[model samples]
Target: MSARTLLVDVHTHLYLPRYASLLRSRASVPMIRSRADGDRLIILDNEPSGGRPVGSQYWDRDQKLAFMDKHGIDISIVSTANPWLDFLSVSEATSMANSLNQDLEEYCSSGPSFSPTLQRLYGMGLLPLVPSISVPTILDEVDHVAQLPHLRGVIMGTRGIGKGLDDDALEPVWSKISDKGLVIFLHPHYGVSSSDVWGEKDNGHVLPLALGFPFETTVATTRMILAGVFDRHPSLKILLAHSGGALPILSSRLASCITHDPVVASRLQHDARWYLGKLYYDAVAYGAEELGFVSSTIGRAGKYGTPTTEAVAGSSHMTFGTDHPFFPPILDAVKQDSKWMSVVENLKAIDGVRDWSEAEKSAVRGQNALKLFGLN
Candidate 1:
């Protein structure tokens, strides 16, 4: 009989007790506290009235295994949840980042108490980027994680150093990470600037979740493209969270804008569409049509101006993810029995794609991530 297919979850998260305790001790946006009415897990701006309830799933290995089993995930490359060291002082951020990375490495190596079949768990390390930490310190941490056997790569927020990912000072950090053969899992922590999107009122985190998160990722990556980061580091692989935000849909338009503007056009060797091919997208789009568009658009190769159908079929760039712990079931729903709506929607999108082979589906489910991060 054929070997059981490998299903990998490259984007899952684990708070891990050591790190969760650190968040609990603090009283800030990234911190966790119990509410009077019920426990909640809050990790965002303006969470002044205290955040969500920190539970076992956030820190418990057993729960992670159970969740993986229910979802048929063969391996999970876990990482620290968002707002990673972004709010601390420069010195404190560096220290906390080092500690968190060590903690994650230790947990994965020690082997959590779960079925032996669930033993393929792994992780992506964290980095500090607050109050302008030095590049050397960042490089040191990257090298440290690279040496760890189970540590695959680093999970980072859009903001690099302080200015953003486009800042020239961050080039060395990116270079070192790429050289180490580590995939940069580019995730978004700070959503869109509050002033630009949502006003004072709380829409139950809808603003950040629905709009800010993906848009922030799109803008950060766009800035990198315009700055020629991809051209400079052609082999540097980045796995974009949330299907590259709006990049896939807006790439052609972004290219058109660059062409029209002589000032921006003069700074780049190639157009915006050229860099789209260099990047990788996750299959987190909520609909099959959107997933199909992302796959067809980014997976296309050949000349720059070639039509999507005419372009050569390229390797699959999408992977599966469940933005868990954050999008848990509402109070009205049964938390344990009901699969997450967000995860279910993503699965359906992948299932609905036409013309994609079983091998391509397996790759999107896990193989591509395995090859990308060298997790095999």
Candidate 2:
């Protein structure tokens, strides 16, 4: 094993006071409101509970530090949680995004008043992503955010420029983002189409959280590949959440599908497998077996001197993460525990993979993220 540290949580979130206040003021899907009980703060959603409780951890910097310390997270690249700027009007989205980005920059650089430990925090900036916004406006925000000292990248949902990531209208946005060397942290906001995955009933957010989120990432990225985005911008760095949401398992299948399609083949300069190699993945798979499979399959090497059949056949493309704040413990579980079950599970999975040296482990935990996002 190489001499390196064991853990870094690249995929965490902090609502940040400014963004939290914005959510509280609104009355829509992304808003926050106190329940009739008056004591409980809940995020507004399209479900029966409205949303989960909004606590200090979601908005307070002190709580964030404490959570990180308890969980053994040496570093965290925080970002706004889901439903980011998607519901706002064009003008409102742009302004709020700028304000939120500025606030995040400040909080990450200087510790929040309540907690000195927050000085260790790093973050990815938010962007205005409403459908009514113009492409140039979106590009401007991306360029501006890319320049912030503490801003390592931009957190974007699967919905690209309105018509999903495959839409040609978004090419310039992708081009500008790629050219700026800003890592695009692709997350999932919209779940699978209801008709295809669920009935008209509530399942306590399980379907969306477990299945819908990862599934959304898979489809959006596949569309981006099919559209030749990677072929056009080979340097574009994308970090897919949830270990690429079955992409490792399904990549070969996707490649086969693309290869068999005459129309897709004729338009692209390279194959789908080639594009996958250019992408990066977060180590968020739930099990060691899954993590090892994803790591080996996505970028494994071939016999002799030939390029591996898998697109991304190297360890550098994988990084560590913990989807925090969103997957808090259930009501009956221990609330004050230092480590979250969700976080520990991911760490254990990565550690349990056989034949990985300490250096490779350290790289996956934080070094890979540091290199990819330009974090020191």
Candidate 3:
């Protein structure tokens, strides 16, 4: 990796101090508990053990910069980790959303200077999308996020206004986001329940995190497309985590199914696959082959359109990411100053992808994100 080639991590997370404090004060499943060794974070309801260890890497700015320096990441667009504002009541969520957004602004804007030429940090703000929250309130939060200098977008879960993303109630929210020119980082929290697959064995979170999470994203986005979200808000910018979570592989099948169903066959303005080109994907698939395949799928979406012929390069629509603080190097895998396997694999995947020129690879590494987030 050349120093001249910028690397931007769009999928990084930070459990800001305020958020961690809020979690510690909670008494329920998503709370944080302090133990002998360290604090433990339990965000998922079905976490196998108690939860993963919480550390300064989650909230410490210097630690984040050090990790970035170790991995050669030039900039990162941090987002609040999963289960954001999910458990809070409407009033609490709204208030905290405001506070967290400000905290995020401070976290990004107050960072130490890394390079004279580089602005190292930016963020994706949160919204109060909990149930019973009025659209006006959410819209106001959107405006607030837009006004924040260091906030480039907003992170959201599969659920939109209590229902799934396809809910009609989210129409106003989507409109406001699009109108504000804010990218929606669509992430997943509550993955699909699969007792049938996992059975009773201590399979842990392997199934839920890997398969269930992406499957949830696939379902939620598919519903949004089927409900004519893209048709309604053509300018909406969404960045999908985990390379759209099996969406590229399953798009053709979904299109076929949509065509076969009379009720939905004539609803969409274009083929189901066309929307892939309009969206952005993070290169966190962990394999060059998987990244290449999804890139080709997204690249081909333009040609699949019914009446539009906008050809898109798949690589141009993808961005680099490291899901830091979530997947750190194991003790056995650690070498002195060694990069995490997770980050290395993703970087290697982008570098090893077939048919991508140096310029295209640079775009995937950081140029795309720079443009997507309007970063300097």
Candidate 4:
């Protein structure tokens, strides 16, 4: 394992008080229901009774800082949690998005310092993305996020505007974001929505969350790639969640499918596999082998447009993340010093990769994030 220089988590989340209150007031699947133990968050339709426990960790800034300190994470780039404005009407979502962006600016800019030049926190803002929202309105929100000093990016779900990310409506928004140089933290929420595939089991959320989320991300990203979103706005900076789901492992398969299709192969400027190198991924895959494999896929992507078939180490495109508060210690930590299993697993994965040197491990741990976000 390499000695730690700095640790940055790009995949952390927070539901600010304003947003939490909105969820608390809702009567739908995305709402929060109060329980005897605490507030329970029911974001997913199939998330089972009692949902998941919601407490200070989801909202309180102090708790966020405590988690960072406990995990030795020096800097965190937080985004709004899932089901973000997805369930609201256009007017309501527009108002809430504005207030939330301002709140995020305040939350991040007012946080304590990790160093003289850097604050411990930065954030990704939101957009009013309901189906009824016009492209002009979406562009307005993008402009709003770009002007916020503390927000370095915008976090979004697979459903872009009304349709999926490949929809033509999102092209202007993509171009504006690309021109502004803001990173897009693309996350998953609707997760394939096919209950029959999992059968009628009482097996908790394991199937939907573990398998469904990643697959949804893969499908969404593939659609965007096929639509040539990357080729249109080549400068768009995007960070994919959950190691780009299964996209890394399936890139070659997708390339083969694309090539075998006479119509599809004629559209793209570069091979489909080349796009893997253009995106960033989170180190939340939970195992050393998966992380290492994802790194190889990303590293090897550079060879697609070049003559050389040699691979390169791609730790620079992967950033460490805990997905904290979502996956707490399964067994309650007896001592305050005990780390969450999720965080530990990700860190160990970075260390346990067979051929990664100290420098590569350190980059995945934090340095890559610093450069990607232009953080000091």
Best by TM-score: 3
RMSD of 3: 1.7
lDDT per residue as tens, model 4, 1-376 = 1225899999999999999999899898899999888889998776776699998899899999999988889999999999999789999999999999999999999999887778889999999988978899989989999999889999999998768999988999999999988999999998977768888878788888999899999999999999999989988899999999999999999999999999898888778999998899999998999998999888888788657644545888899998877888756457656779889889998899986898899888988988888784
Q: Give the TM-score of each candidate.
A: 0.90, 0.90, 0.96, 0.96
Descending-TM-score candidate ranking: 3, 4, 1, 2
How far is 70's C-alpha from truth in model 2 (Å)? 1.3
Best by lDDT: 3
* 1-376 per-residue lDDT for model 3 (tens digits): 3434888999999999999999999888798989898889999886867899988999999999999988888899999998999689999999999999999999988986546755689999999999988889999999999999889899999988888899998899899989888899999988888678667888888988999999999999999999999999999999999999989999999999999999999999899999999999999999999999999998899887766477999998999999998978766545666679879999899999987888898889998998888864
Distance (Å) between predicted and true CA of 279, model 1?
1.4
lDDT per residue for candidate 1 within 1-376, as digits (tens), equals 0122677777788887776777778776677776777655667766545566668888787787778777776778888888788778888888888888888888787765324433467889988777568888888889888988778889988878789999999899889988998888899987876565687676766777768889999999999989989878877989999888888889889989998988798777666776777777777777888888877777643356334424534337788887665567665545557777667887787778885777887777777777777854
By lDDT rank, best first, the candidates go 3, 4, 1, 2
Candidate 3: 10-residue stretch with minimal lDDT: 330-339
lDDT of 4: 0.89
Q: Candidate 4, which ten residues in sequence have the lowest lDDT sum?
A: 305-314
Q: Count the clashes in each prediction.
A: 6, 6, 0, 0
- TM-score result, candidate 1: 0.90
Q: What lDDT is obtained when candidate 1 is compared to the true structure?
A: 0.78
